[model samples]
Target: MAELYFLIYVIVFIVGAVSGLLYSYSIHLEPFVVKEKFNIPILIMAIIGWIFTLNFSLFSMIPSFILISIGVFLIGFVIDMRPGYGRKETIIGMIISILIWLITHCVIL
Candidate 1:
């Protein structure tokens, strides 16, 4: 059951991030249409994802997976609208991340 939830979370995170990226690029693209630009961040995000996956592989996969997910979600959210990296959106994301982390912890652990 826990593994199922973890897999679901992974899928949701990837789909959400990819879709968000595509949406963002579509809105910004003006001169040419290239998909490669959309995938450029995949490598970076993959590295970060791999590192988080390693941490999960070492410790509790469930909790670590959730933590990494919250991290990824925040990254995508901030990338969309950082608001100078130290504004209300950052604080909101942090608070929301904590609430999500706590809620998932309580439900899963």
Candidate 2:
């Protein structure tokens, strides 16, 4: 189950990567998805989702993950630790990652 859980998380992360390519405005009737990959940080920040839902049942993991996430973001952005970092896409990834948490909590252990 844990293996499957992680695999699902990978799929969710891919969805987030796709979301990163999308923009609010589109060129003509198509090309809303950007050709340039600008959201590498978003894809790399997949751990954020895992941390976000760590507290669904385990209270400690939740708070710890939240703190760690904040620290990573702070260090990454404030210190410019990472290049090609996309905040928006990372946020999207975090939201999408929650699906795994929901599934684990509601359907599995």
Candidate 3:
């Protein structure tokens, strides 16, 4: 069961990463240029998700995930919309965090 949950997490994470890449491209954010730089943030999000999964029950985790994801999205949106910044690393971070939360909480053992 634990293996299955991990598998689901990996699948979701990959999908999220790809989606983030596409989204960045669509907005002309040039993810490829800074792809290597964002690795630490993405890894941090995954670590946070893993910690949440370990500490909380599925029922509790769902709402937390939703709130966290929404917050991350809003932050990312705001950053992208800022006049001078023009970065989209937040989108990638958001995707990773949300997908990790979903996969970790949704899997039935």
Best by the TM-score measure? 1
Candidate 2: residue 77 lDDT (0-100): 33
Better of 2 and 3 by TM-score: 3
lDDT by residue (tens digit), candidate 2, 1-109: 7677556555554554444334222222343433455445435454454344443344455455344444344323312212233445555555555666677678785
Local accuracy of candidate 1 as per-residue lDDT tens digits, 1-109: 9898778666756665566566656554555443332333433444444344333443464687576675565355334421222233434445554555566566667
- Winner by lDDT: 1
Give me the displacement of residue 6 in model 3, in angstroms: 0.4
TM-score of 1: 0.36
Q: Per-residue error at 53 for model 2, in Å?
A: 6.5
| Order by lDDT, highest first | 1, 3, 2
What TM-score against the true fold does each predicted structure earn?
0.36, 0.34, 0.35
Model 2 poorest 10 in a row by lDDT: 74-83
lDDT of residue 18 for candidate 1: 66
Number of colliding residue pairs in model 3: 0
**Which ranking of candidates, highest TM-score first?**
1, 3, 2
